[model samples]
Target chain A: MSLPLSELPTDTVAKVVTLEVGQDYRRRMAGLGLRPGVAIRVIRRSPLKGPLQVRVGHTDIILRRSDAVRIRVEPMPQTRGVPADAAHPEVVPAP
Target chain B: MKRIALLGMPNTGKSTFFNRLTGAGARVGNWPGLTVELLSARILLAGQMVEVVDLPGIYNLHGFSEDEQVVRRFLESQPLNLLVLVLNASQLDRQLALALQARHLGVPLLLLLNMEDEAQRLGIRIDSAALERALGVPVRLLSAKYGQHYREALAAIERSLKAHPALRRADRRALEEDQHIEQALDRLVQASVHAPVQLPPTLSERIDALLLHPWLGLPFLLLILFVLFQAVYALGSPLQDGMEVLLGEFRRSVLDPALAGLPSGLRSFLAEGLYDGVGTVLTFMPVIALFFVALAIIEDSGYLARIAFLVDAIMQRLGLDGRAFVMQLMGFGCNVPAVMGTRIMRSRGLRALTMLVIPFSLCSARLQVLLFITTAVFAPTTAPLVLLTFYVLSVLLAMFTAFIWRGRYVNREPLLMELPPYRLPTLRFLLHEGWRATLQFLRGAGGYIVLGVVVVWFLTHYPFDAPPASPATLAGRLANGLAPIFSPLGLDSLLAIALLFGLVAKEVVIGALAVIYSAGPDQLPGVLAQRLDAIQAMSFLLFILIYTPCVSTIAVIRKESGDWRLTLLAVAWPLTLAWLVSFAFYQTARALGY
Candidate 1:
């Protein structure tokens, strides 16, 4: 089942399924390691409609909630640390 | 001289390392890309002079972030003998990509894995030998904050300096062909490093629980800011007073007698206008240094990003993200750099709006002016409180301006900041940052303050025989000409002259009075104290707090925004707003019989 990343509970591990945004926006998101298939978890959310703090692999990223709504994530139950192929990989390479 | 540049992800302690290597000073902020400009220092490496430059940090190679663009510009323009890649060892898994990309730069590389102690505590370990073999470059561990393995790092630098010159861009085609880095990294990490599945919680986490707590964080942040201004006064005012005592003694005994040879009017202007004007500006050095301690702590500690996070909700409402608050904090030091800071935002509209709001922040120079006025006018117990009132007004004015202008510029661009874990700041770091800030104030605002004082003194005291500040004087005539505009702001002609000179720099607001009042350094405040009653003092303080920023800030606004019209709006709005706010307050206070 897919859901908006913002709707995920804090500490719930999930994998990004799709980024419902444009090419440039997706590229920017990828720079922060939030592309499709990264295992991500919500670290916390700011109060009163602020931003969401998330961890993709070892790198933590703080992004606004509205932006978070564009990302679709699938809950990966029973995993505290699902290894992302390259959630801000050991090396994202030249590709 | 050989050149080496340190490049890394933000908060990797790269700047701290640069400081130790070259003994140079620059503002280093925890928020990513806060370096904003290139900083370079000269040091002796391998018994020869070497130039060490610190590149603005970036998270990715291809990211279009301003920092990445800056790094690209540096690489395109400056040929380097070596690039020292600094990485937070604790986050090596995520940071190594930049390393792999930097390798493509064709410059010989040295991998400096900083924060080794934190990494070790987190049970993350790297086999430097194996990684060096795999990457074909040297690897070394560092704790930049603690000065750990510093000597060893230097030795490594010397050893790498002997490496054959890289073909550099000759490898561009090869870099383009480079692919499948994900699997390569997976294989590399498996062979060379023990990667953690999840980071173990540490002290930073516990602190974040309270500090980043939604309900508690905001209030605690406000309280901390309140205390910060108070602490600045508590620590700075005494130094200012002691310095003033010494300067006053010098002015009274030494300066007065030396100038005695001149005629009375010129002698007074020379003794007080020239000497005391500059002297009063200099005595603020200690206070300015003290003010930087707050900036130093916020920058050095990782809490700057946290404050941005804390205020993000409110900032979002104003059509800005948390990062604009970081620039505002930067503005507390000075607004020119803060205007340059708007580059951290991607949207052009947001940058314009942020630049508009930032000058309203009470920068150190302006704060120095306010400090003198408030201490002179308000009782000791309530002086800081009065300053706090002005500070509050400054913030309100910034928010109000942002609120009013957000319709045109507020973009809800997502804030994707890396909130680095907080590090404990050292006393050495504090003193180093304080001294740097003091020098910066002298450097950026120094010339303007001098020019403003001299010009104001000449304008007010010219026709050499005219009584000081008399209507026949140039400054008197100018003020009389503009009195219709400024008089409503509750400023008389002489005070209006000071305000006019203040456009060059706010420090001259105090410095200008030194000339116009023809009083010695310590006595300018006393003169103003007698002239300005409570109602008038509040009105004047409000005007100073909200008036146009210095020409330097205005010039930067023009350059950064690249819109002459917007720049004019920046100047116009503040002057008009300052008038409206001060006029309302003065009229209301007077109507109520104050």
Candidate 2:
């Protein structure tokens, strides 16, 4: 299922579908290796709605939650065994 | 002279490479814009003198950010002999995309794979020969920090310049397509790079788990700040005292006796005006140096970016980027560096807003005067409370100012900063950074400080032939003219004049007060108590806390912002705020029968 990147559970890998934002933001993110079709791992998220830490290739970047919400991502099919915590995702997708 | 420009993605160790190539100490922080302006140094390479320009880091030539525009404009205007593209070997996937984009810029290029040691540690290796063949440029793998493979890079640069390689501009439309760039990066990475399939959890990730934790991160940040303040005080105070004593003794024993042969007016001018004015600024060098050393270590270790990540939400609410919080922390040490430190902020609006709020950070100079007043005017038990209140007010005022200024324009920049892997800060790098910051501070702000002191000295000393010139001079006359304006805050002519002299530098206020009252430092408290009641004293302290920044700070603000209107606002806003706040405090205290 495709969702905003901010809704992706920590440790889940996903491919960027698109950045549903302004051209400038998309360009800036693209320069940082956040281009569409590129896979990224949601490594961590701050507890109080802070920035999300996403690993893109070998580089780790912090994105504000607001910006993260604008980035569309589709979950990658699990290649390794699915972790039990994946069953109970922490983030609820924005309605 | 032929020109070569260093270009790369942010945090790719471009400045470090620039420092190595030019043997210049260009500022290199983990964050961006340490080289905000174009910095060029003349170097003799292989018997040819070439000007090497360190351009601000840019993600792509077509990028819209200010730094990218700077790079774009320079590339368009300057006739370059060679373009050196620096890349982080550990993150070659993204960095190479920038390299590919720059190659299309039609500049003759030499690609440098910097930070090869980190790449090696990560079990990532790049075949530079393969990459060079693929990109059609000479490529060298180097660790600029360790000076690895620099000679080969320089030789290649010389060769590239001599050969005058053909320039081919990349298709602008092709460069604009995101998917096209990504596919090209994938192709380049697959052809030339090798890495372990499953990397271990890195040290940086492990540290970030704790440092960026929601519950623990804020407290950790506070603890770091607490420790930094303690370190600055505990380490800096003894050195400050020692320098103070040494300079005082030299003035009394050597300088005064040597200058006794001159006319008394000239002697006083040389001793008090020139020496003492500059000496006051010099005495704070140890503290300023200590602050920068600690800041450098924090920045180099990559924790500063984490702090920015941690505080982005809170700072955003105040209409500032998270980076402004770091600048505010630096302001507590001294606002001059804090103002210059705003160069790191990429947005002009953010820089201006951060600079505006920084003056309220209770810098060391203002703290000294507040410390003096609190200890003198209040009881022992209440002194600490008063001092704490002043600090709290400083922060509150800064936030309030930011609150008013936050929505002036809608800031569209997202917080998309790279979290660089942590590395231990080398002592040599730390000391060099500290020394360079201190020298920059002195070189930029020292002249204004000296001028201010000499001007004040002349104002107080003019009509020198008059005996017992004591506060009856032109400065005194001017102070008397302005006294009624401050009378509501319980300031007499002497207190008013001392504050006027404080425009030179805040630290001189206490000394100016001492001179005005014709009392020794030890007798200051008694004279102060005799002149004013506790309420009035409190009002005066409040005024000192919020008044206009010192002359040096204004000079730096002007230099950094390049805006006289903003500099005028910097002076006018604080002065107005100081008066309104002090007046309110004094009136409220009197109405409440304090």
Candidate 3:
């Protein structure tokens, strides 16, 4: 099941489905290694609707929660041998 | 000389590599755009002179941001022999996208995996040979921070130079290029990058958990600022005082006695115009230096990026990204560097807006004048509160200016900045960076300050031998002509003249006041108290607080913005605000019979 990336709870593992934002935001996210097939782990979100910290590949990026909400993601199924927080099993349905 | 450009994403140790190769101390903050402009330095490698240009960091060549545009324009304009693609070893998966893009540009490329030491600490091991073979480029593992692997980098450059790799231009209209690059990066990383096990939360992560805590973060930021200001005052004031006394003594005992043989007019001109003017600005050197040192430490440690993250929400409301807040904070120390600091912002409009608001940040020179006035005018019990009020007013005015100017520049890119891992800044690096910044500040603004001082001196002393302190000289005549306009704001002729002289610098206001009133430095407060009542004094202080920025700041704004209209607005807006605010303040106080 897919939802807005911002809706994922902290420490949840998700695969980016597709970005629903403008072309500019999409290109920027892509430049930062966040593409449709990339696996991202929601690290933490600031309180009071602040930015969300997400790990894309080995890079951690802080994104505004609004921008994060525009990114569609599907949670990866929990599997053995994969850490609870790490986003493994990159297979997910495209948005 | 053949030109080789150092290209990388922001904060990937590209400038560090540049400094290593050229021995040129280009500013290297952990934050981006420290080297905003292209900096070229000559280095002799293998008996051949090579000009290495350190281009501003850009996320992608295709991005239309200021830095990206600058990099793209330079590549298209300049004939370059080689491009040095500097990548953060630990961040290769993401950084490789830029390298791949650059590679497609068909420039002869040497891959520099900088920060190899940090990658090792993170358990990130890259097989450089395998990567080089995979990408068909010479790759060298380098720890630029530690000055390691210089020979390897040079050898790679030499090898690439001899091979004469063909340049292939990528189609600008190819929209799917980035996706192809990303896939290529994935393949390269899977083949050559190795991390044995998933690493636990590192020290930076653990610390960010607290430092970036939503509830605690704001307080942490405030506490850091409070401590910074306290240190600047505690450590800087005594040195400032000592220098003031030293300069005074030097003038009286050495300069005055030595110049006795010269004509009195020339002697006075030298003593007042040149000596005292420059001396006034020089006395604040310790304070400015301390501020830069502290700022460098915070910037180098990577906490400044966290500060940006913390303030992003509030800054967004002002139509600026969070990084602009750091520039504003720097303004509290000095406006010139703070104005230049706006280069870090990717949006041109955001940079201009930030520059417009920075002059109201209550820089150290202005703060000194405010502190002097408050303590002298108000009773001790009320002085601190008055000073606090002025500081609060400064911030409010700055925000108001930001709000007013927000609509003028609307197109801004989203705030997507990388938060580099925190590291302890070495003392040597900190001092070197700090000293270089201090020297740059002096070089950029020093001549203007000196020129301002000389002009003020000339105006105050012309019509020679006419009772030096009398209100009949050129400065006095100018002040009298302008006094009527300021009469409603409670500024008399003497105060008006002092304010006119203060255009050179805020610190000179007190000095000018002393000279105009014929009072010694120690006697300034008594003289001020006798001349003006509480309401008038407060009005004067308010006017000084909001008035035009000093000559140096105006020059920097003009230089940075490169628009005379914006520079004029920077000056005129503040003067109008100061006059109107002071007028309303004095009238209200009088009506209340204070």
Candidate 4:
């Protein structure tokens, strides 16, 4: 099932499916290497609906949950032997 | 002169490398309508004259922030001999995409993988030669902080500048719009980078378990702030005292006697104007150095970024993000750099608003003013409480102003920041970078303070015919004219003049008081106490707390925002607010018979 990235529980691994944001934020997220189909692991979320720490590859970014709510993602099962060490995951390259 | 620019994502130690190359001699070049300036310095590299510009760090050139736009514009517009791409070697998975993009720019590229030590610690390795071949650029391992293999890096830079090879335009497209990193980035990394499978966890992760703990994070932050301030004041106060004593002794023994031969007016000008002005700047060196050095330590250790995370929620209520809070915290040491630091914000509106809010921080200069009033006006027992109250009021005022201004500058930009791994701050690095920051503070604020002191001294000492700033002089007349308006706030003519001259620097308030009273610094505080009661003292203190920010701050605001409206608002709003608040406070206190 797909859900807003912000709704994904902590420690859940997910692949971004849709980033529904304005042109400006969309470009910013992309600039930060966050785009549709990129894999992200929810590292930790700040308290009281604050920003969330998400790890992509070896880079960790602190993204505001308010902004994160606009990006939709589907959780990927941990059963596979993929996501090597998780951070710096070997997902398919961006087109 | 050969011109080169350092390009990198944030936290790559690009600035550290720049500092190593060019000690503190940077000319900050401001972009029209942008909050940030490009810092460029001229240096001699291997007997060749070169100009090096350090661009603001950006995740991607086609990014959305004003920082990104500025970089893109510079790369597109400026003539450059070489583009040196600095990367955090430990995080090359994503940083390489930036290198790939810059390669598309058709600039002769030299890739420097910084933080080589950290990469080795984490069991990540890169074959610099292989990567060099894959990208067709010279790649070198570097430890920016410790300057490991520094000579080799310099040799590489000199070689690239000399070669200035014609860039390969295989893609034939220079960072085109909507340019996505193709499989090339992965291909390069797959060829050159190796990482251990299921790597051992780092100490940073274990520490974050406690430092970033949801509930404990804030307490740890406060504890860290508490310890930091205690350490700074504990160490800085003694150094400040030593500087003050040395300057004062030289002035009495050497300067005063030397100037005693001149005519009275000229002597007084040389003595008070030059002495008080320049002396104040020199006296503050130790405090500013120790303060910034301690700050660099914490920042270098990487806790400052986590601070942004912990403080983000509180900042959101003010219509700001965590990054803005980190900049505000820096203002407590000095407002000039803090205002300059606002360039990190992505939204122009958010940056402007953050700039406005930062001047309200009780910076070290203003902290001296608060301490002065507390010691002279309040009893010793109440002094600490009074200072604490002032800090609280400063915060409340900043929050209140942001709450009001956010409506006009409301921005919904995303807050994206990198949380770098924690590492020990090297002493060698702290001294180099911290001393550089202190010199910057001096260069920015020094002349303004001297000018203020000279102006204050002239106004208070002149008419040559009058008894040193008597009611007959221009300064006396200013006090007389302003006294009528200010007396209601419980300040007399002299106090009003001191507050007026405070425009240059908050610490200048005490200097103005010393000049106007014609008493030595020691005697002036005593004279101050005899003139104002506790009630009036509180009123005057409150006024000082919120008055127009020092001239240096105002100048930076004008330069950074490039908008006269915002600059004037910075000056005018504080004046009105200070007046209303002090008036209300003074009246209420008198009514309550305090």
Candidate 5:
């Protein structure tokens, strides 16, 4: 189902199924490793509001809550329950 | 010799196309007067040498940006033996506008439609011959990304060049056919080329909704900025530390003993002064290089365009556009190229606004100041925040200054920009661009760092008098004199000495301090290794971030704007704001308890 990132619960890992965003915009997101079928680990909801920092394919790409809404995602199976921010900083190979 | 100019919008794979045609010999560089310059190369066709020029990408040949003028001028001046107009297949309408413009220029043209593979994947199609009949030129559907269909294009060019004498239009019949041709395009599209041109999915709509929301966007944008700065601090520091170790080894192993056997004066001159000055500053190259590499990935992947789009409204409010914001982002890497890049903006007013605002972006040299200061005072826990705050302040200062400057200059153009489809940036290209940027930074700043060190050395060493009473003897006193003007800004000590040295090159500020602080009065060095305090150090960093950009940027501004008045304004306004902001920070921090 469609949902804004701000509406998505914290610590949700989801596979991006589709993005209603424009082609140019999608290309930009895809550049940062957020493509259809790519796994995204939602990091933190700004205590103030909106932009969410999510780790996709090892790079942390920030997206506004509104853009997050156009993306359709199915929650991934999660057992570790590790918070995005508290997750240990690991050096992912540069994309 | 024959001539063909490959022209189109930015990110249309023009550079890639140029690379494919000429390999590595094309003169590729940011334009001298513009951030994006036209590239010219020679291509050999069937044993005949033909010159191929790649003009800077332009949405139109009209009055949008400076590069547009360059493109318009080039087209107007020469009889292009054949105009090779490359259009992104996915974005045909806009690309067609340029094709129409080229046709109007009265040159025999060929439409090299690129990105066909992706366009076809998305279910788009083109009746190549039908389009050719409609536009009165040949159309080649080739994917420049993979080499498919490229040979055909080469063969077409070779044939066109060989038949060059007959290719030139003899009369106005072709020009008069354009209106009839326009109708033909409509009818032909209906009959032959049928495909879906749906808006490609993008996060921009949602991001723009949130980012442009009156209430949410600004704060969210700020928060993202906070995180970006935090990342810069978080990621860049360790790299910087490693660089420092390498520099230390170099100094200890090669520099120190090499000068030891010389006369005491000469030994100290080369060792403590020249070697120390340049070496100390150059140590930060690793951090600068890594930052550019990260930025290049973001840029090449096209994510950077989305950022400019998301922030366009805010920038517009400040009298700029998304393109201008892209240049501002590049300013963080270096203001010289950033200022030059203002050519991407479509309007003269907007171009000037972007150039004027660039100095406020915290470049790598300023990062050296931030890293050195924050590490000195706050523990790692607080250091990131201080660094973040400095960056935030610099941005705020830049925007506020832009707003004030906008009172004088304004653009009436719409902020609408074409966004290229995002693809993953290739690793090979990213590394190439990263190394290119790094080498440029080193080449531009490294020399100044060495020169600054030697000059400071001469000022300190040549004075035959007894070493004075102050910690900094000769040059130190001069710096102290200059320090007072900056003292009201909260950096009273010989730190002003370091800041003055920075006027030569920002990175040298730390090196200047390292030398001035390390040496003693009697010209006999003291054992105490001194460093700057955190609070005052932060103030110094803040000042450097806001100061006028280096001479190179000023030169670019003069060339781009064609007016010294605007250039002088760009230089003066930023320095004034920087001085004011640093002063306020210093005074407020002292009164609060720091």
Candidate 6:
């Protein structure tokens, strides 16, 4: 569903459908590899209602929750598979 | 020996790579030319020797900030044989911009994908070979955190050096925002990568709820700062006290006895001047080191960026971006680094603004004032309250100074900063940083402290060589001259003379006093304990805290601002404010019958 990023819940994991940042900020985000189709895991809900710590690839970024709402994503069942001692379930190591 | 420069965005494990490469430790250094300081290390990699200059991290090579200039200048000079472009794998796009800029420099570049493990953990996949093809450089994907990629990166560099022997420089125009190059990078990233990444649905809604709540965020920021200060003071005090006593005892037993056989003038000068002044100040090294260690740990763990986010708006009001707050916090430990940290402030005006307000951060030298007054003036119970007031006042002074600078030179741009994640700070890293700070303090005390003590002793002891009214007492005369200037502030004593001696090094004031006011152990109790009264003591504390930062800090300001006008402004403004504040407090205390 298309909702602002700020509406995300504490335990939710989501894929970034799109980033609705300004041109300057967009250029910066693009440079950081935060493309439209990147999956990000929310590590922390801001205590000050400021930003969410989303884990994308190997880095965790704090993006304003309002920014997150524009990106659309679908929910998947929380996998309980031995979690692979992995941080991101979707990532495959270099073969 | 081939020359190499390590370049990356802030928080990319470039430092870890340096440690892994050279086995040399990371410590702060004065970046050549600029007063701005950054981490640097000289390491011998492989059999053939090369110096790896760790360049300051920046988002873009095209910026006016001293940090950006530092990189640009190094690139322009063609000083290095090879440029090691370290990229945070987790944040590739932004890092690539810098790498692209490096490519434009046309220097032989080896791109190392640092933090690959963390990147994998975050569900991002990268094809190193693909990226290597795209950038026309060797790309080694390994975790600097675990030292996984060192061998591959090193081997690649060694191989490249053997084959090429000389590096090629890229044309500057090639890096100048060419759409063709940008499109090529995009195409390369898409073709070689096999990840259609998406944000998780649940986490999105959760963040939406918290960060968007206007009412909750600001208070949370305030609470975080409160807790941080409390932690700094609570955790640091006992360690600070222990060091103080140890240094005091060492002086009394070892240093003091060594000087006893000398004439009373020589004895007092050596015992009190060198040992007491610089010694007492250096003893607080433990606390200062603890503070810096805590700060570095927070920054490394990535939580410090959040602090920047939370306070960005307030900081912007001071003609500074929120980044300056981080620098100011650095100022709490030492203004030298804090002024240097101002390099992170993007705008020149904002950087200057940060530099100007930095001296207000109540550095370690001011800690002596805090300790002395809190103990001497108020009842032991009121010590905490006094300490709290001083901290609060320092912050208020910072805010007030920001307001003044904003009115004079306002930059109305809103702050946009990257907030890094909340990871637990690693113990190994924290201890390493802490040890460096502690050692610097010890070395500083050993070198500058001893020398400063000797100078003060010479100033106060030789020439006239008498007590109370000795002609050899330049320190006494200077104090007497400066004392009246402070009379309105209600602090005029030998302690005042010590404060003048303090201009050399704040700690020297203590040493000067130990010699200037020498009653035997029976007469003089807990150091300055017997000399100054509560009201005057508090005034003395207030004066030191606010007056001047120090000579090193001033020199750094002169270097960073480049204009002597700004440097003078940095010094004069703080001195005036300090005097006014101390006067007000002293009068208010006297009115209350303290």
Off by over 4 Å in 1: A21-32, A79-95, B25-36, B165-180, B262-277, B319-393, B404-414, B486-545, B549-571, B581-594
Candidate 5 residue-wise lDDT, B1-594, digit = tens = 677888887667776677789865565445343434556778687787777888877655553345656765565555667878888776563246566546776777788888888678756677787788777888898877687899998888777776664334313343223231233223444544555523333454355446545457556655654555456446766776677787778878987777668777777776766766666555545555555555665566665655554565356578876667766765785565566456545567777777888888888777876676566556779889988887898788778878887867787554333344467766656565545555655554455556655665565555624342223466567757766677777665566655555655577666565565555333311211124455666677777787766544555577667668997897788778778878888889888998
Candidate 4 CA-lDDT value: 0.79
- Considering the two chains of model 2, state its CAPRI-style docking category: acceptable
lDDT of 6 by residue, B182-281 (tens): 4444465565544434423334235534543456655665565556655766677677767778887887788877877788766676566666656645
For candidate 5, the clash count comes to 13
Instruction: Tell me the interface RMSD of every candidate, in Å.
Output: 3.9, 5.2, 2.3, 2.6, 13.7, 6.5
DockQ sort, best first: 4, 3, 1, 2, 6, 5
- The whole-model C-alpha lDDT of candidate 6 against the native structure comes to 0.63
How far out, in Å, is residue A17 in model 2? 0.6
TM-score of chain A of 5: 0.74
* Candidate 2 local lDDT, B1-594, one digit each (tens): 677889898888887788778764344322233334566678887577777888888777677787876776666656677889999999886788887777776668889999999999988979988998999999998888888888887788889888873333334444444444666777888899886665556888778878887789999998987788679768887888899899999999999999989998898899978997788668767876787777777777888788878887788888887678987986887787678777667788888888889999998888888888777778999889888889999999999888887676335566888889998877777776677767766876677677777887888787677432256778778878887789988778788878877887787889888877788999998888788788888888888888888877887787777778888888988889899999999989889988
Ranking by lDDT: 4, 2, 3, 1, 6, 5
Candidate 5 vs. true structure, TM-score = 0.66
Report the candidate with higher DockQ, 2 versus 4.
4
Residue-level lDDT tens digits of model 3 in B1-594? 666778898888887777667763453222232324456677776567776788888777777667777777667656667888998998886787787677667677889999998888878889988987888888899888787887788788887766663433333443224445655767777788886447556898889888888789889888987787678668877898899999999999999999999987899889988997678568757766776677777777888778767887778888876667877876887786678666556677888899888999998888888888888888999998888999999999999998988999663778676678897876666666557656665665566667877887788788778755358888888888897788998888888888877787788889888888889999999888888888898999999989999877886677666678888899999999999999999999988888
Query: CA RMSD for every model?
Result: 5.7, 4.5, 3.7, 3.8, 12.1, 7.2
Candidate 4 residue-wise lDDT, A6-82, digit = tens: 88877777888877877667765655567666677787888877888887666678988887888888888772334
Task: Name the 10 consecutive residues with the lowest summed lDDT in model 5 chain B.
Answer: B521-530
- The candidates, ranked best first by TM-score, are 2, 3, 4, 1, 6, 5
